[model samples]
Target chain A: MSLFMDLNLPFTADKKRLKTLLETAAHLGFSTVAINYFHEGQSKGKKEIPKPTPLAQLVDELPIVQGKSRPIKVLNRLTILVSDASHFRHNAAEYRAYDILAVQPTTEKLFHAACMTFDVDIICITVTERLPFFFKRAPINGARERGVMFEVCYAAAIRDSTMRRYTLTNTLALVERNKGKNIIVSSGTDKPLELRGPYDITNLAQLFGMSEVEAKDGVSSNCRSVLLHAETRKTACGIIYTVKTPNDSQPKDGPPLAKKQKTSAS
Target chain B: MVRVKSRYLLCEIHVSDPSKLLLLEDRAITAAVKDAVTSAHGDYGAAQCSIGFSVKYVNAHTGILFLRCPKSSYRLIWSALPFITSVERKGRRISCFLSCLHVGGTIRTCQKFLIRYNTQQLHRMLPKCKTQEEKDQVRRAILSSSTYMLKGKEHKEERD
Candidate 1:
């Protein structure tokens, strides 16, 4: 199963720290990393404006390959705090990252804008306090209305274990209702250290009412689809081809590698 | 590929004189149209009304609005459009028509309405229009300038 690690390093986190985190993720079998970066001065109330760091530099400098493994993909997390179409366009112009993980209570106008500007794959609705409002404004039906995939971050599920069932049930109902449109369920955790792997995430989905197949798809296939659609990764289809010398090639003379042939031989 | 089943209450109001349409006040009818649409579909905030549903066309002057509903809930809501105020058959199947005053209604009036009125009214009432012709009409109406204005108002309230 493919793994994705959310790299929520602080703005102050230097390149060295980021390198260490990427190394750790690569070592642990993560195929993709989603880096969440927001302007600090906007929130910190600092008048002394720091020059905007080019996001492209981070993408270019990120250690995507370790040793001889396939290069790990890096995606910038463009979380729209409140759905602002202009802000999304501005961000798209500035960063031009592969994908956006937008938070909602945003208008369909803005959602469409982000998708058009950045070619967004997954629009994550941050249903923290505004669960009802979030569902109302950007209803599962509305996502279908706008012809876009809608993702729900189970904040309450991750925060309070007791609320997990309810969140899961409601989210599942939403997913079932909008089955054709893409629905992604995530734990919306910011700290990379606290994230859960695909298997654990699958287990959580199962506990919350997703069938084994559904849970597996949600964590592995669904998550991959989201990350791949983001700006960081160019291709979502995880197809890799390896070329080998004639001597290194496995023998095609071995009965076409079918299990039936092996069993018959045995 | 997204199908929504939306329910709207179309009240004829039984005005004997058709020429007295001016005295009827388009706003009142529009308000009723808005109320029926909201009650049947759910509150989508005025701003979202235009873009959220399959509103083919609306002629507030003649009190006619054409809408689409997803197939799943079409039976529950669409049939009830003509008889919204009647309690005996509030959620039962019934014949409905679009006001000729509005464009495109004459051609697609017989189209079925799908309604699934749950506690969440807005999402439930949307119709799943399968045919490309029906889907295109709904998309155009929902994304029109008037509907976007309505959605913008609802959005303002959320921000406030």
Candidate 2:
């Protein structure tokens, strides 16, 4: 019964607002919470992008709440408008630390690479009402044109299905096939209010043909694993040595320098 | 040097105490060079890949080894039923398939082997070993030792 909450809403400049949201999520019995930041003005085509709040600042404010609570998993949700393969490669490298980077691939090769090389755990193929401006000028009334459009449409449908089965069958298959790679399913919703609960998300999985176990795991376990990885990276910063104990100092037959230190200390 | 097509071997070693099996280090095996070659090149062509004595039994408690061979040189390794001892292969790339079996040993020994080698890759390489006797010994050593436990099959009955 793992619980999760997504904080993809427009965060108020007020610290109190953020605290209230966290507290509300905690009260709602969520074991994890994901924080998504949108590149402001991109939604409206405005040139000015809103500055994102730092993770450290958010962590600092988290302790302000009063009671003992389950650890709320935090993740950064990034949406990229994919125009080229190089763009995805560059962005993936830059945001490698992020838990999930949602991208809508224009081609099957691009999508495959996104999942493979870039380590994209969740790929959100955007379902747009109108095709991108670039596709408009292409020649029509031919089989090639229809084939291109058909592939694009099929890809979108597959992506939607992927989002639903991410936790269940697809993720398991990916894990089985790739061994160490991780795959997570995300709604890729822009608005916080639009974000679905864990149960609803699971139900959506069933609607998309995911089994009950698969649906639950997609939203809970898969997301949990991703969030934990992000948390590990965050906390592991500058702390390389985890083994800290007097007995772990060094074995008697270790390096000469280590033995010398042991002798001197003794 | 036998020119054999690429094949895989899937060997499942079941042990009593898997944890104990995990303790066997690379140095524990007298044949380090053979083990290294087997791990790197696999049992395809002239390259004879095999898991050394440092095999870590992850499911030490349950005493089960789940092996998957995608492709391998020798298919007879599977017939040999090497759940306890060591696997020695003569050629390159083996066949790929899955094998599940119970053996001896603790969860610790299996863990040690897992730590030293790539468990998944090694798991895929088990069935490519040379003889049923060698395979059986490896399986017996893995299953009987007190090292690790088979992850999902902890409560299942042990094979004789």
Candidate 3:
């Protein structure tokens, strides 16, 4: 069985609260969780993105996951909100430090661009209010083809009734356009009490118009795919370059003379 | 008479302030559950739940309550139960959560199960009681609670 994962846990500076959040997440049986550090558009003069706390520095001992004897896996994720095209600097060096990259597009044009062209691994779907623009099919299909998942957050819904309506309506619209494919559901909550169990999240997805299998995928398989896609994004289409260590004693020129001809023969 | 299948839900209410539990009533629970269903699932779910929804029992001291709904729509009610963040009573807001313990077909079965569950919880907490007096107190509490239920069951059998 695929282990359950919640890809977004809002970052909090308070150490005590953050520890409680992780402990609650572990008790809720999430095998993996990502601490989401958000950076709004750099409309402000300061362009500094907050750095993620290392796992060891964040918690002395990781809590064991419920029903899974092993400790939970923690990851760092960066979600950048794009309002204007210029807000996202091309190849922003600061983004490379995180494990996953995500973008929240505010405008219809930016949404299209983020889905079709952005190099990010995840696209966040706004859930606190009614979607400003209709989710068009072209960009959504492009995103699906590119292996980028659309994220639907449920924490806001849990907090307020009005937001619940917006969350369900916006997600249903997206589901209608995409036929329940390439979607992920996460709790965008900073409070430990606000976070629901992974199985609870799966059931909650049904309120957003997803079928049972699709809802299950929203919590498990699709998030797995997004993590793998983030890996490929770090490398050149899954290729990596390695530097030779000083201990390397192989021939600097070429292979041995005896094997040189055979190398050329191939 | 046509027998309508029913699902009995066993749940515990967790309140930040246990004193506020005194305000909980059967009507308040039903109303809170309706509001939760309406908000989480919308009007359609609320309407479905209204057909066969009733609060069977509430023990404010223990925070355990029983709800019985039409079997087919019990799941709809169950999912929305978690969304109830608080219950209102006489202008006082009691922040709380409804954590489900079990679901059964009859109240008798639920009672039997609750006894077993409480005794097991006692066993789990026995190792945590540091002082000898506390350990013995817990032991007496466990034995008395279990025997109380078993004695009640024996009387019911004799009366039947």
Best by DockQ: 3
DockQ of each: 0.01, 0.01, 0.14
A131-236 per-residue lDDT for model 2 (tens digits): 2322111222221212111101111222233432332343333333333122233444322222333443444444334466765666566565555444444334
Whole-model alpha-carbon lDDT for candidate 3 = 0.86
CAPRI rating of model 3:
incorrect
Worst 10 residues of 1 chain A by lDDT: A40-49
User: In candidate 1, which residue ranges exceed 4 Å CA deviation?
Assistant: A1-24, A39-68, A83-92, A95-103, A106-119, A134-147, A154-156, A159-173, A190-192, A227-266, B1-160
* Per-chain TM-score (chain B), model 3: 0.84
Q: TM-score per model for chain B alone? A: 0.28, 0.25, 0.84
Write model 3 residue lDDT over B51-116, tens digit each, in one string: 989999999987889999999998788878768888888777788777666789999899988888
Which has the greatest lDDT?
A: 3
C-alpha TM-score for every candidate = 0.40, 0.36, 0.76
Q: Rank all candidate structures by their TM-score, best first, as comma-separated numbers.
A: 3, 1, 2
Clashes of 1: 36
Candidate 2, residue A67: CA error in Å?
11
Return the lDDT, model 1, position B120. Answer: 17
Task: Rank candidates by lDDT, best first.
Answer: 3, 1, 2
Residue A105 of model 3 has an lDDT of 96
Ranking the candidates on DockQ from highest down gives 3, 2, 1
lDDT for each residue of candidate 2 in B1-160, tens digit (9 for 90 to 100): 9543332221233222344444333222223224333432346411422421223323424223433221342332232221113322332222111122222244444445543333333332345568988777666565544344453245444431
